[model samples]
Target chain A: MARPFVPTRMEEPITANHREARPSGAVDTRVEGVVANWFPRFLANGLDYLDVTRILDAIENWDQWGTTWEAAGENYEKLGRDALAAGHSETAGSHLRRAALTYQFAQFVMTGDTEARRRIHLRMADTYRTAAPLLQPPATPVRVPWRGIDLVGYLRTLSDDSPLVVLIPGLESTKEQFSTFEPFLLERGLSTLSFEGPGQGETWYEHGFRDEAYVDAMRALFAWIVDRPDLSGRRVALLGTSFGGYLALKSAPGLPVEAVVDIAGFFDLKDFDNLQPVIRDNFAHFMKIEPAEIEDVVSQVDLLGTLPLDVPVLAVHGEVDPIVPVEHAHRIAAAQMNATVWLYPDGTHSCNNLHTIVRPAISDWLADRLAVGA
Target chain B: MARPFVPTRMEEPITANHREARPSGAVDTRVEGVVANWFPRFLANGLDYLDVTRILDAIENWDQWGTTWEAAGENYEKLGRDALAAGHSETAGSHLRRAALTYQFAQFVMTGDTEARRRIHLRMADTYRTAAPLLQPPATPVRVPWRGIDLVGYLRTLSDDSPLVVLIPGLESTKEQFSTFEPFLLERGLSTLSFEGPGQGETWYEHGFRDEAYVDAMRALFAWIVDRPDLSGRRVALLGTSFGGYLALKSAPGLPVEAVVDIAGFFDLKDFDNLQPVIRDNFAHFMKIEPAEIEDVVSQVDLLGTLPLDVPVLAVHGEVDPIVPVEHAHRIAAAQMNATVWLYPDGTHSCNNLHTIVRPAISDWLADRLAVGA
Candidate 1:
């Protein structure tokens, strides 16, 4: 019998728009805009911290920017500084999280870092132990596949008429976390599907699917999606986050998908193996299994040796994403012949959260590609 | 006691240029240059084979101003077709490699795949074993390191007044492999030192310095370099190739070196880990060690974490390098604060042999930055 699924506290949803009380000061519009724009460009630039800082600095000093946003942005900068000084990255990341979220809601709304922005906002609420009343939870849930097994997924749909877009969450992520983009996509007349593949969410415990099965499960899902009547056989578009980027690319050659997007995805699995500690830490649950078995399975699914796909590919990555470093995107881009790469200078993996900008752009892209076909 | 170094037959000097005997009738100069320029860019653009073929068709039929370079560019179309049909990448890569190298030598070279262009040229001597006569032999003979060390290095003086520079060879490379650049740097009034670190030459057999020890050895070397009085406290610069790119960036932080130049270097170590079989096969000489020892010593010298250097950095990487991939350069650039990135869309890691293009650029860069008192 498989183990029972028990979601971690981090998986719980906090209230939306639970704006933290301002610390007795006017919001800085400039900082807000800077923070808002930071994530997309950062990711787009392949996650370069220097570029992120430069953009952040530029936005913080924008003319007529708000004070509150500036304060929040300053706080984030301080957090980063503190994290570096104290070697407490998680804490520092929290500060960036708050700054990104506040910037999203502030007067100088940022469009990028939508995921990070959302996460920051949610994390802020968690820190305060209060849920925002404005935040709405996901509407419907979907099923994600792993090997031959399936796990339930919670989805927030966007537009039915638009192209059927599937979002593959990163390691340890669930569909619930996709609330960051689901509604925003829906609001823009685009349909979005977010799922947790093998070794993630309920799949690991319920079905015992390991990370080695990720590509196969993703392939099966692609096969299933293309055959769906509701999707109307529309060209399937995939947006893979973090490690999912690698999974998406790996499965692309075998799937009949139209367009593929990798956000901070790893292209070469061998590269991941060299850094044993990182793999052990990130996939600790899966690593407890037999090494030889895992190696055999991983070898069969290695993406680097896989041939180029016959579809269009779009890679969205952060220049400064500490995890899932931007180089992975570069490798994917290099290997494929039909790939479009957008690097955000300040973005981190699965961190883009400001909805005001990314939502519209992503919607526009989907509309131009999927809506027209539909 | 250390076993004497036994150089490979490929290392021996050639009597004559092999290609000279082959009729130029088969060669399409125009197509060669065009394909060379276009292929690397296509790789850099991350296009799939379909897109690449489509783009090639467009370029061939497009009635733009019919320049000789463009006319010659059609050769790539045939090359691409041949590559696809060849099935094995080595066959395809050879054709592309030829075009890229030839294109670099072209007077009116297209500006694309800068790194690929260089890499093709640098690796040309090795890849096209018959073309050895066109290249010069190493100035110095391969020497074993002290104490049966896995690697051996020597700091040969090019000039007393010149700036100090360290040369790091590529995978399966030796200090002698840098014959092209060593003399070029010396001619440009720069002092260059070459070393066969870790997996390349003597180190693999003598010191048993594997992948994990790469950064540590580099750090130790930098520490030793800084204390040398013969160099007159001159600012040190690093020139790395292929795997050396990773070492360059990994060692950048916490070192007294002033600048680092990466030629087809890797940005992330984790990505390489996934290709354990390939890595082990190609770098077997470097990895014949106990894993426990590697784990114990790597933490103190790992480079993925926050780097502490504020030095200037220059990255010259091939956009289409099949071995190292260009994303590595992107990652390094993203992480470093003061970095100048030069992308040769068509160049490969062996940027030195791209008709000495990189040699001059690097020489100029070193002259500008490493010159005493500006």
Candidate 2:
């Protein structure tokens, strides 16, 4: 008989920011923070109901949270393998997707044990790679040549003639989450290519996060897109969510993109002190510097009056957003010569509270701008 | 210039049940009872964010909640029509679907007003019929001949040779909600046909809710399915949600089906008193009786040694289901000689809490049982 599934992570030591205690300068109240951080995933089918239940059950104390998620992920991954062996590709895809989500959540908000975090991250990427091919239409893996390294991406297409839209994920987010957003664009006849650039996903291990790394990497990705014979688009739009939104706007002036979509993205680093501890720490880790040094690094980041005037822009932001304030949206929109701004009064970070409206609207805008299928 | 949209409903009188005060025995504690009741609709894209926000802003003390949704719905329907005129079929479909959702919510819990409810219901059905054909794969409207009347359904097909699974919606739910569930089955080569039978959708106006109407309608639907040349399948399966779970299992023995999938359905009416007021009221409205008479009507509902022994079964239920008790799953499973029961410990009504796991598992089970792709 197979041995019982057991996660092999060493014990984490006690720290000042225990799960029970509220971290200093937390963006939201504990309950809201917990729900807001994970509820979107549940809505996106990134996390299963059972996983949410387990997390909710251990709401007050979360010392075992990482280990619990890791074990569940491993078990789901095993199930996926078993289903694949049985020639049930659909079932395997479902299980593996869930496994990837679980693995991603295993390290969510966890800042300890770099080796363990890396192990889980690798497992997530591997699981996603294996499962993406089994999905309907299938996601073809891409390796764009970078400086002495390679940026990884997944190209999901309905046809070779379809227009391309490059997706940029934000801090602490991976391309795996784009499964939720891909279908909307695909249905509109726009193929999507989402990748992990410098300081994002697996590439983060090689190149530490810099505020400018995102735009630089996007430029390299655009270069790669220009050369790909399989991809059919002379000019592509860049869509960035959260912090990636900044990258999309920043790169628009430099790249051969027809349009740019920035959703709940930051325009200035002036509000660095206002961010939640978790986000601040994650950004600092990506910058390979202490939290204190983050302000100085971010001070150099700004998009006021820097965006290309020719590029049509769609910017969506929530007034009540805790991470990137609503002012960032105003700044970006003001700087752009041609821009459409959608401000949600009761929206959270990323305008997630208004996803049903914004997602379709964004897709419509992209399709219209790209003249996809025309 | 295009004429501005205007709703035709007159002003409503103040009622005992306002937005702030919960009707006796209401479940949720929020001031916005109506919004809380259907917030998930917005989350699922059944309703638009702007519409929902409009409703919430005017929700301090609603005297015309039904009219509010109806006006919002009419505005969206107008938008849909305008989009269609502009040669944007995809946009038209989305708008129409959202319009249908808004119209559905208009009369969701308005049991006291029958004429308004029927009018809104007709609008919902009409909009869905128009939008269904615009969707990818397209929904072909099917009218199965019933006793002196025609039962309405939408046949969503991927291929002519794919297996068929008929979907049954529960109280206050419609085929529109199945948009989320159908893709899973279709991915595994099983076409879906979601319909309104007896006390549901368009059929409800013709034949008011009768305890036996669901089974009777299913019988008629099966007969039609067997004869349709456009659809191919020797035998079909029935999958039902909420109250329809009872209908699916109850009709399984008599219908010419190969399998049944019951998600969070009731086994017996013994626990009728434990239900929430809104659900009980809706049931009463469907039955064309008073809330006090519902228990007597439901008392006739039970399944003991009634399910077929030959057909395989899949039953999913939430342990903490607010509407149907977990014991119903136990009783239903016990009665069936071959049954698989998945009871979620911390699940809500319909095990919606466990949708990621339950949806895929049910799809796999149905595919395996009917040999859909084989």
Candidate 3:
């Protein structure tokens, strides 16, 4: 572990209502809708090329998007229910999973109205729950208590002897998107538990958004996993993507975790003011506050006292990441001597553009830390 | 079956010395190297992202390319051989296959010198031969006897009762690149036989190049597959890419095959004169003929008399394909009744840009025809 390096103030002035003043070309329309979602959509499609192609075929532009996904979700939902009626459990499970993913994507970028987002997210969660029992080894639902409410999650068992990895979704991501990523961990002898802690999916409805709520949720999750009869492993790892990366880092300090993966996460909140409006709007909406109050809460978010995580940390960031600055990775590495920071020269935010490289490396890193296949 | 549709002459004149005359930005330097070879390189890297990234990181431009791959091949070759010496057969097999692929890519686009091509091709073949026996289920090398010579190939078995599919490589492609594509076929419970016929790999060293040689080679391959006690498929399907697409269509008539998959292949030689110089020169070099003789021989290559294939056909092509026009797909479908032509509106050559759509559809179509998964 290295000495804690206090972060410096912002180099540029933080503009008020920064979203409107930001350059239009920063996050191009194509990048916002299609390109940014390719890997995630591929995951939702169960890595099936035909299904992905079919999705792409329906929507030619952003204007014709929402209904296509809704229709697709309905189609798959009908197919799944019909298959279940026909006693084709395997086929029903696959179709229902597809339906859940389709519903999730429909609400992926949807914000502004809580009622619509809640309706769509509830459908996504419900469909996933229906399909979970038929999944190989099955994903059992778990509710970890936080204050008076409960945080929703799913524990996907690989084996009792396998290491457990808690999957934390980003601001826009939900537990439903873990269908593809969960397999990588499972194949490497890791049990995956995906859940929305705060400011994500259904959890956003109850807990709203607070950075500390995520840390509290992780603590509760760890406690629950330790007590489960089917689950083993003294220490668990937190695998977080995007904003979830920040949560993983926040929870890493004093948390009983063997490893922490912060993929395109933030080291400091100094860059929060400079983020795109789409991102800023979503964060503010999740926080259950007006856009103006975002800066005050975000400013309180920093890794000032958090350092020397001691546990192995893996930070992957794209050098040209438009969403999260690459400097965050550098700062994380500088403050933590045991951190392995991989900065891709041509990668975008989350290095989703470089999925082929990032995905496998993360899996292998976690497997090594967990001593999988040993 | 629909009546044969004779193709009309080109509406525009073919350009002479087309390489220099073509638009400057058409095939950009980096795109010319990378985009054209993504699939092959993806295969060479064993479909591993880290391996591919390592190869990409080593090179700044195309000029300093060949030696890097040669060194990489040598490195893997040494590692594989050492593992073999230590009786780590599985590890050795995987590395040797990687070495063979690296060697193949080293000579992938090298066209000027036959000697260099032969040297690299030999190394690729030798390494693969050593690794083949160690592959899961093993790829048995079969020498299909041709006129006064032999065509080297590998028969990758899935099951004795499974239908066999013939993998015909494109002009620049060879059997070495089938490492990834073969799995798609095998997973569908189909056996794959990837071979180098005339104008491809070692076959070009011995028999030179002729369109008819491919048909002859397929005939020999079918005979061999039938005679093998371990192989029990009544019929075989021809799945070809690029020039192999053309060959698949050419051999579809009177060939004892269950189906044909012509991906981005052309129907007539009328468009040959209008092709890019890199393509024309490669064809001339393979044919061992003057560039002027290319058009004459190519002009004779048309599907006028050969049509109404009594088998299922899947023709996948990009609508805006630069190399082979999309109209070729339409013409092929018009001439053949039992044809499923998929034209991707925004796809590039061979529809590689639309691989997610094209690859799965072809496999599913072939599987449906062979009744493999039924």
Candidate 4:
């Protein structure tokens, strides 16, 4: 999402202890604006409106945004811990799970200081892992070796024979954000594998986002899925949002994917110089490289080179998506041998504004493609 | 509940066919204000924030509130029906269940015309029953004969031996609103019986709220549970909110209830003249009685005469509750032989504002009392 008008990346992440030397009004206004627009996205993605409302209300100081959210997350974490002490496993699981996602958002786009962001990200992962076993369908942590590091995933199955839906989070999103969407597929008897590729969530500290490395990670991941006796025979679908959508298509050509649901995916990459500075800066932050290197990375993230994927694909996009243009969806559908585009005319990024209808519809579409029930 | 507000009851409920003669601006503003305050309650009781936001945003005409919500409910119902036709049972069940609650809220305070409110209420009941069998641990629609009519409740059990928690809704709430709270108990090896006594939901039009009838309904409900061989020997907890809390305490004395949770229960009924007209009118509307009779009705709905019960009681209230004061919790606790006052200093009516913590905590407290797992 290349949206404009708020939260420019700073040279250093604002820590709990000090105020960054930036103009407070400008930073606060922009951040508040971003927060205002993301209400629909946050609610659709599983952040309780109450939680979102309270945290946003409490974080009047934009410099302390991360640490403020971190404190609120710790409150939930303590509540979860108390529930666990009382032997209320489900309550513990739900609260701790909420804490994980809270911590995830606490660090989201705080790329001003990657070190601080990574530390918070690691805590999110730990909280998630702690909640994993207590979930209704317990999560199975997945680790595939890549670039001398592990590409991380959390798999949750509904039943032994359930089909698989591999979910990929967006540029700033992580595996934890799939908590809301996972239910739509899970309720349809489809298991889910929510993963973090290179330069995402867990491994971002060590492994940077590289075009070739992303493809390699997917390659390794697919192979690992095949090797698992439990997941071998099941049909599979790939679903990714934003940047993940671009990568899903970029990687699907040579992979064993049966279907793909790409939300706001990219068909052609914009020139780094022509793109918004905020976009370029975020890319640089995510890539762990300089802004100039972003051009090379974008050059490799295009779908043109990997044309004509035979797998069924559903391109879901928002016509008014603040970031990627809706033209990308059209371009993507046009290039695919079998594809359809479901674009919401007045939707924001991810059609999150239309989530009430779109989420179930996409899960239903995936269920149809995989012949899940039948 | 007794706060000052805008909405004054109309002589007739607004109909889809024609607009009633009402001041649009005043009506709309007041209704909007009420909606503004109900966010935590709505989310806490299972309304998706997106749905609530969209519906509230769309309803500029306060006169059309019922019809507008009714239309939204139908849309979800159609979606649920389509999912069912496509064999997505779980998705269908969830959507339909949502539709039921949507329809329930559609008529929550639309007491302008008892006939119209009853019609929408029936639709909610039908939709809920349709979705019930598709639900996990499928809800059993219970009908016990009373006053020459069948009393209503929906029972869902985790297992053959799971302890039962009987959930009673607030003054304007129905059995369907229990959808959100049921999960806490269900997730903790407890069964739930969501009931609508004499003047609650489906039967409100037929049997008015008489103090004797209210007590008799609980007696009949407890007896019906005893007769079920499937639920034999299981522990039972009674939980009621707002007016339901008053009813629960007012009726628990001679019943076979092992535990009771009274959230925002009234310690003493204020004089009808002293109560806010909105609250008085709403109570009158719910009771289907003349406002003049409210004083006599309030006289009979107190816990003073029936106290000193040996059952474990939890009086959960807010220190600054808008309706029943925190003193209610203290008074209830004082009257009961074994009781605890969980008074949140800043909680709203029914402690709905603190639901995320209060709801699970109450369920966990009940679990501990019932010896649910050991």
Candidate 5:
């Protein structure tokens, strides 16, 4: 018999629609109290996740995402042992593969090292081949086209038909970041899809597409996924990481997304109001815009303004992040009523060891919503 | 009988010298766990402390600390309810007076604002007369020479028998940042001393001393404080913020400091390997060196290498700080086994909300040592 699923402790109840419209008021107080009480153990269990998040947040804002990816990969591998010991076999396997793939992606981004990326890709192929049979349906590769560029992605079938979760890679990231978890979900009967958008992996420099084009391409990808024979008419859940987090939030309203998750995502393109000069200058170059233009772009993509999100949203942020401020997460959560915001006192952009803490929570949430369709 | 000073639950046991030698291990995992859980609640407890700390950190790092004294005064007024509730009455009074004095100091630094500075000084004098007794020694005017120029400082004394705690303001800061806590300490039978060190408050333009000379002046000030009869040759605890954190760490070996606390301090200046460009440029100019030269200067002041310190040290950092990365704090903790380190998961540079959590810990540590001294 399968083990009964245990849900993680409820983090402040999902913000109801009525609560979102009003000032956060006493709910914030109550939630904060809960957080303060359990922060240390939460942190110890989540340090690696926090470290990865911090590194990713820094990379997204600083455009040094490439360098930190390697670091994050190493950390993920280190935490795998703990995950396996805790009986989270699926989580452990995913993290190990993610670690390997992240290192490959990092090398590719940092040095434009194609051979290193290919080596990792081969390793991923082997891992996936071994894990595929345990899943609901064999993982299928799909080619997504954006601005005459072809991007590769994997689609997994669900045991109970549910909304498709489309995972977007950060700038220079590939579909591999999601490969670790795809099989776990497929085995659990949850359909999932992950792809590399423009300016990432094989699409940007390889296909000559730029950053701004990604938002539209993501929308198109969602449309394409819905039309697929196996996933026809499915609602989509978009999960983004770091730079991808920003892209995911920005793209959510434009697509037929039922829910969205931004992990250490940026809400505005502008540098933080109190940013040090170094950050401001470096970011200006990364965004290819002047300091004066940042505010204008930020205004356009301000997550504080409702983007007509009609589904549940989840935002995870690191507390001590120097790159993306936790305020960004607050703003996003504040704007969405059906949002479940989980702040890891010691958690960062992407979940690592702490992922275990949030993993059950996320799976439970997804399971509850997906069960509706079932 | 004075409540027997039962330590708060937040206070971790001080392990033996070996535990101190491995400071990271010394951190009570239990306390960290508690903090992690309670973080959100701790933050909502009116984030006023964070605001205050930011203003103080800013003032301390200001190029002309004296000029911003008025702002400090304003902050004191703003902090009224919170400070009083926290038992920081003396700190409130000192900050108000310091603000007025800082305004005068700012004038002195502004090149053509001498007359304005004089007028501000007169106002400060009046404010001091009213607020001084609220502090320990009552405010008295004193002049210290720096780089052949005389700079003014306001001396407030606690009882001569009390343990002396010296406050070192950062760059442009005056003594006003400690105003809220100063009087509170005095009332608690702790002697407090605050000064605007060189390149701060009155010393910057007034003495034609740039920021580079701050370490020397702080050294001199520490030496002078030790020799004073009021201080009774007691080992002083030095609390430093931002750039002042750096200065305090540097001065640790030179001064017979009993304890040192650094908030958001940097370890290696050059290790800001991933800094945003604007900040890097600004810091470079402030340090009067090229970016390439940062590595060399970092070697001289690397707090990690300045280890085996005879004195107790506490390094506190915010994980999400945009100015100084949380890793800096981790590196410091990793380097020195004798240092006590506390990290706020969602804290930013000088964010006030963290104070509520940290203050109790700080008070307990100070009281423990002072009681032993008695």
Candidate 6:
């Protein structure tokens, strides 16, 4: 680790690395800051507990957050490259995936510069792309032509005849972090297409958060599914989480998918102002506007425009969710023509803390729904 | 999962399995009991976060604790057997090892019948033995003849020319839980022999806790090492944990060893009275004595008799250890002629809570100490 890092990676650098940005003042990194909120995320996700403990030990300040994570990621990237060179593809895939996961968390919740967060995030995407082909039953990076640009996705299918679960990313979350979710799909003998829509993941560089871009991305997703002979015949289900859940419902009208599952979706932006300062700031960063100006933007977001979805819909919400109220799930379920509401009594946002139970249940519910048409 | 009791395992049951024992009435599980002390141990070790959460959700009462764990262990045992039947040796080994760990925790602490606890303990050893031969590089179960019966040890070596580290188990911990600790030794090209001494693991049936049996087992270990040409003349270290630490120190005088590592070891049994009721009860079970009568045993145990050992010794203790006070480490270090004490400020019992930092520190310390004589 004393040796300077020369990352063996995918995609040449487009921006200067986040490593140069150092905290300028005496850092007060209360180690307990990471204990409560972030521990469950790291635990539920694939990050090794020991590695997280080690990585989080040095990160007491937001200024060093992404940088510390990037260093750890780079180490794994080097290990992956060396393992791959030695013809250990299995080992390489695992290591590179770990590297990608580190980078995913690096960009997750940044209270620092927005541009630096994107730089760290790009490394996540690149590391994951490097791992994609090496993963067992290899995933393919596909670009679908959308609104004069290509939206990125990773297509992983167990069988041609299996139903396809189109997974949409939420704010600050990309397809790379969906690795844990993919196993349930794979276990059920279902195909998975984890897509990065506009304002999410790689697509953010081309198009930031905008209503038109989001609507077009969903249209392009279904269009691409129809175009592919292998993917076209399979029953389709669109499963979205958090912000993406709202987007899924917004674009649900007349979509070719047979089923839709909205996980912790917002029914309206009335609760946006109620979000924590850190989260509000994160939201502002995506919109590139002041927090005060968000009321105007809030007025523009409402699901009633796309209500009473024709297809079978499932709304999954955590009753104890501090961010989004459980009533949102009830309201959404009440609106949709064929929607069912599931409220996990002890779940947090996205039910990530209850991932072991909620995830499999969601997969099972979706499988059952998709099976009806098949 | 719906299928009933049939275990594909190494041992034919001499005692009926603990699966039949059920709580008599309304079970007051109070899961928070597990949340405080057990979570860190589970997290630091190799258990999957999701599996633990799911498993803990079902275990609320100590009355059904061992029975619940045995059911989970049996599930994995079935999965392992099925995987092995399908010629998936690596997968089988991993699952079987998990099965072994579940059983390890099953018998860790019991508030009910000691015999039920013993029944569950037998499964842990048997399951681990079944997995030993399938592990990568393959671990072998070796029998070292003691006074009359035999002691079981899993010998996992990376190379022919390597120093061997004998890992001693604590009051309830057995060789089965040492899988997490073995990688560090393997990485350093050091051979590991995780041994279950008298009143530990499989050997408990033959010889329960007693001074003669404990001393003879340690003596027999070194004798066996000398007898085997492959093991003979190699540098060796006795690394004991908790009660095993006391035993390692107690047996250190006039032993054939180069180094000794005492992890959260006892200097004397003076602090035994202050231990938590559950732990004291567990220790009492091992001794087959009432808690109050343990004064006779406590008076007989002290490290002053074995003070100032000639061999290089490293005493690792947690400063904030709730079970064993940090004072004991200072006392032991003060007594030893050549001893170094490493007290982690934020570690719990056996430094199991600070395992991520303390474990590697230990492995590094032991490697450096052992290398000097090599």
The most accurate candidate by TM-score is 4
Off by over 4 Å in 4: A1-27, A271-277, B1-29
State which candidate has the highest lDDT. 4
Q: For candidate 2, what's the TM-score of chain A, rounded to 2 decimals?
A: 0.87
Which DockQ value does candidate 5 get?
A: 0.01
Candidate 5 per-residue lDDT, tens place, A281-372, comes to 43443344556877754455455554437777777776655556777776666666446777766554454324433443454455455553
Q: RMSD in angstroms, all models?
A: 26.6, 7.3, 14.5, 9.9, 24.2, 11.8
* Best of the two (3, 6) by TM-score: 3
- Candidate 2 chain A has its poorest 10 consecutive residues by lDDT at A7-16
Candidate fnat values, all: 0.00, 0.13, 0.02, 0.14, 0.00, 0.00
Candidate 1 A-chain TM?
A: 0.57
Go through the candidates in order and give each one's C-alpha lDDT.
Answer: 0.49, 0.73, 0.71, 0.78, 0.53, 0.74
What is the lDDT for B259 in model 3? 91
- Which candidate has the highest DockQ of all? 2
True contacts kept of 1: 0.00
What tens-digit string does per-residue lDDT give for candidate 1 at B1-374? 22332211111111122344435465544454445434433332222222233224433312221222222323432343354463323323433433333232231122233344334334433332322222222133223324335345645465455677788875545554454456556644567777767655445444545554676677656655655667656667888776676677666667677777776676555554454343434443345545455443333333456442477777776665555676666666666645677766545444422322345455566655776334
For residues A1-374, write the lDDT of model 4, one tens digit per residue. 21221211111111122234344664476466557546677778767776676676656566777887888788788889988987888889888988888897888778687678878888998998999999878888888887688888889987767889999876778888887788888877789999999878776777878888888889899899899999888888899998888888888877877898898877877645665544566677778887666677777777885856788888888877877787788777667745766777667788787687778888988988888858
- Candidate with the larger lDDT of 3 and 4: 4
lDDT of 5 by residue, B1-374 (tens): 11121111111111111322334434544334323333332232221222222233344233323434355444443443343354444444434444444343333233224466556555655555555655445666556665676655666665556676666665334554455446444544566666776545545445422333666776667656666666655656777776667767767776777888777778766756676443454344334455687665545556655764677777777777676787777666666565777676656564333442344345445545565236
Candidate with the larger lDDT of 1 and 5: 5
Clashing pairs in 2: A209-A286
* Runs with alpha carbons beyond 4 Å of true place in candidate 2: A1-57, A61-86, A211-215, A232-234, A270-278, A290-296, B1-88, B211-214, B232-234, B268-283, B289-305
DockQ of candidate 6 compared with the true complex = 0.05
Higher-ranked by lDDT: 1 or 6? 6
Interface RMSD of each: 29.9, 11.9, 32.0, 24.0, 27.4, 17.5
Go through the candidates in order and give each one's DockQ: 0.01, 0.17, 0.08, 0.15, 0.01, 0.05
- Residue B185 displacement in candidate 6 (angstroms): 1.8
- How many residue pairs clash in model 5? 68
In the predicted model 4, the residue pairs found to clash are none
How would you class the docking of model 5?
incorrect
Candidate 4 has an lDDT of: 0.78
